[model samples]
Target: MAISSEPRLGASTNGDLVNRVQQLRLDGQLGAGKNSRGGGGALLPWVLCGLLAVTWAGVGVRSYKNAGQKADDTASAPQGTAPAASSTNTPQPAGPSAVAEGELVTQLKGNVIPSLQITVSPRDVAAEITEIFFAEGKRVKRGDKIATLLDHLYVNRLNTEVASVAAAEAQVTRAQASQTSVAAKVAKAKSALAAAEARGTRATAMQERAGKDFDQARQQRASGSIALLDYQRFDADKQAADADKIAATADIEAAKREVEAAEAEVKTAVASTKAATADLGAAKARCAEAQRLVENCVVTAPIDGTILTKSADKGALVSPNSFNVAAGICLIADLSKLEVEIDVPERQITRLKSGQSCKLQADADPTREYRGVVDRVMPIADDTKNVVKVRIRAYLKKGEQQGEFLKPKMSITATVYNTPFTFDPSKDLPWGDEATRK
Candidate 1:
């Protein structure tokens, strides 16, 4: 049967038709074909993907902002705070600070010293050192026996000199006695010559008388008044008288010769006396020298101080000419008076002057300070070290007492304070304007 072209509103043949129509209408709302399922399923996945993308973008933005902030902090940080890879890096300098010109005072202390040095010289052979009476650090006084030399030989020589002097004096006395005796003999010889001359004159007068008698006898013979025998007897008598006169004259000449010989003896005696006197004087001088040498055998202290060094020992040969390597047997120093010697740079020496106040401090006793005055500043600087040796006299101040414990050759540091008259033309000085000129 042919279906009617007209619409049939309520003619439901099967229930499938109604259902198909309802499904078709549902498909239309959803979409058609593959798009319908794909679009619907993709909606949930797309939403989840959108949420993940948004979360990732937010994390990246946060990371970028944090990195930029860190870079800004790094750029603004201080340079000093940065670490260096090597140890050779230098540190930055500090801020500027003010500086001033001021004096620096120091304190020093030292041992004492002697003002004079004494040495003994021996004239004879080298002496053997008998004993050394002093040791280092031992205090000694003037005239104290510090050392001794062998005295046996010197004593013997002195004795010999004494004996020689005595012998010479004895000889002088003997010569003087001899001279007196010779003088007496000379006087006696002179007297004898005078008596002999007087006798000779008497004999000549008797001879003349005898000759006259002989002549008278010859005349008598001529006149025949006397016999020939008598006249010959008279002539013989006259000849005998003349011979007696000649003998008397010869005796007088012999007496004169004896007197002259005696006078010569006296002269010789006087010469001997003079020679003996000279020998006596020489002997006495030698005796005195021997005495002086004996006294020198006992050595004495030359100064008042403490012995600081000693090299002499018993049995050692000591000679003044010997090398003084260790400085004569012992060294004496005056511990009461201490001084410091320092070689100041030449540049600084010009600023120092004598009588300027100074301070000293010894390395041994740092706590104790000593005050002193500048004793001397060398006018010339030493060429070897280009320094001027300055000597300072340090007087112990009241209340600070270091007695005999101070020793010589101790190392010390010293500071010399500027004197009031020190000249400085740069600025106003501590002293008055007049001091500046000096």
Candidate 2:
């Protein structure tokens, strides 16, 4: 209702305002309508109250229409859009954000994964699984025998190598003996040379003596004091002595040649000895290598752990590097160590960091909560899922670290609260120091 500031007494209007108010007041429509000259005090209050009442009624009608219109609009609009704001006295609550209820916490879902799972394989050697030493699920110390491959084959190879080494050793002995024999021959040749030289010296002396005798015979014969035959005999004797000296010198040279030949034979024998020694060493090395391979046939536990599975039994053929649940020699794990591995979505990965504490609940026992820490935060991400793999080391309560409460490959939920903290590595110690599994 539009109220006019001035009195509308014009004939063009629906009716005179005073007359209208007078009729409504008589009918009790207005609270009081007595007219007064003093600024129309009685009429003013009544008129104002009537206008206010009309205005509120119109507002109520419009509100009802608007509500219907909103309902229709909402029904016709797309699935998820919110309705327009409504006029209310109180304010609306805010949605979840960084400062959630004045605290910062990040929760993630992950599964329980193995921390010290070991699957023994026959890595480079293809051999038949000949025997299993320990029972499955039994605890074993490091270096303890778990199984044995076909060692008979390797043992045969080792024996053959040993025989070869022995043969090479014999060859080396024969070469040494040959060297000794050549050395003796060289000594004999030297002795013969010395004798030849002595003989040449004696021949030289006899020649000189014969030459003097021949000269004396020639002088006597020429002075007719000796016979010609005697002089001729002395000349013949001198010539024979000269010939013996030449022969002796020749024998000395021949002996020297023989000695040189013997020395050459000695050198060849020494070389042969060295070659045999090298061959023996090589054969022995081959034997040692074969022995090592044979040793590998006996498989041993690499860590103090429990055997989770036995994939291969006696007479089963196992290829090196064969692994998995279907076929393998055995699968072992250190039950003392456990971890929860979860894939944190790329968006939430930023809230997690190494050393952050986490609360864990297994799918098997959701009520029982376990404690753990963020052991690692991978720098890389999985492109397909857009997530990062995080490993959480489980912290067993009291002496439960060595207990069998948790098993590997158990599905579990991990709740991690993002906060700054320190992680102690010593808390995870006392691990199996058993020999590293082969």
Candidate 3:
């Protein structure tokens, strides 16, 4: 409707231009509307995209730094060596360590033994076992009695011998008195013989005087001057004196013989007395012997020791020299003193000596140990085993307490050290030097 001034659509030059402008305006309107809708939707999307881009950038930078650190560590490490093998290659040793060694040592202490043994038995008296008075292992003095035997018969014999001695003594006294009586008879006989001799001499003188008177009377008769009767009387008197003289002489001789006989009787009585005295002495000796035998029947203790074995019992018969039906009484031993016999190797024995120190360990008690000194060493070797037999007297150390478990005949081991040995540092040692050895 406004066609008056406007160029018409079909006008030559301006028509095309005006239609093109209208077409451009319509296209611009559509483009503006579409742009407005898109702008509103794209606001939230663009904000989300910006936050994502910043997060991705931060992740990439962290990854790059981690890779760089790994590369640096790889370059710094040692090459061609495993970590486990490197530590294991160093050398280490194992075992118990050694302490100080190579000290000067003397003979190893050990046990020894007695070379000979002696058994004692009773003599002179019969032995009987009664009560055991001593314990085993105790000490005793000599001459102590150990047992006794019955002696009733010996006692009776002693009494009989004593009576015999008394009887013999009485016989000696009676014989002495008889000897004195015989001596007195001999003295009286000698005095009577002397008086008879004097009488014989007087009778012989009277007989000679009467004979002379008779001859003178005969002469007077011849001369017829004297009486015949007087002469006859004188002759008779001479005859009688002759006869008396002869008798007196014979009586003197007989008295002399009697004196000799009495002297002989006295000598016989003295001999009898001497014989009686000798018999008394013999009887007394017999009595003493019997008494000694009786006393020997009572036996006592021989030593203060315990009995190890009983060989006889009560009422068993025993002999002085032999055991007879019974075994030889009891055996006893002293236990206060102890000894051990050991056979050491010949090589080991050369290094041992008396009075050396020793350490002993009994197999039965491994934890317990004992200390002893060597009291003796044997010079000879054992013939059977070809080993050196040694005897050791072991005395417990003073003030040491022994356990009850210790006993005789227990097996034991001992350690002996060499004497006069030195530690040489220059030489390689089986055991190391002082600091390294045990």
Q: lDDT scores for all predictions?
A: 0.69, 0.75, 0.60
Stronger candidate by TM-score (1 vs 2)? 2
TM-score of each: 0.57, 0.64, 0.46
Among these predictions, the greatest lDDT belongs to: 2
Give stretches of model 2 more than 4 Å off: 1-105, 123-125, 201-234, 321-327, 366-369, 401-403, 417-438
lDDT of 3 by residue, 1-438 (tens): 444866656678545644654454433545667666665533544565567669989999999999897775454222332222224668643431221233222222233222222233334556454443344443344456655666767788999999999999999999999999999999999988988988888878877877787778778878988877876787788889889899999989999999999999998999999999999999999998888877767554454444445555556666646634553556654433445566665544555555554455667766766554344667788778666866554444334332233445566555433232233334212222235422
* Tens-digit per-residue lDDT, 151-257, candidate 2: 77888999999999989999999999999999999999999999998998898899899889988988898899988788789989999988998998898899899
**Global CA lDDT computed for model 3:** 0.60
Backbone clashes under 3 angstroms, per model: 5, 3, 21
After superposition, candidate 1 runs with Cα above 4 Å error: 1-114, 117-125, 200-248, 323-327, 347-353, 366-371, 376-381, 397-406, 417-438
Candidate 1 colliding pairs: 107-360, 107-361, 108-360, 108-361, 113-334
For model 2, what is the C-alpha lDDT against the true structure?
A: 0.75
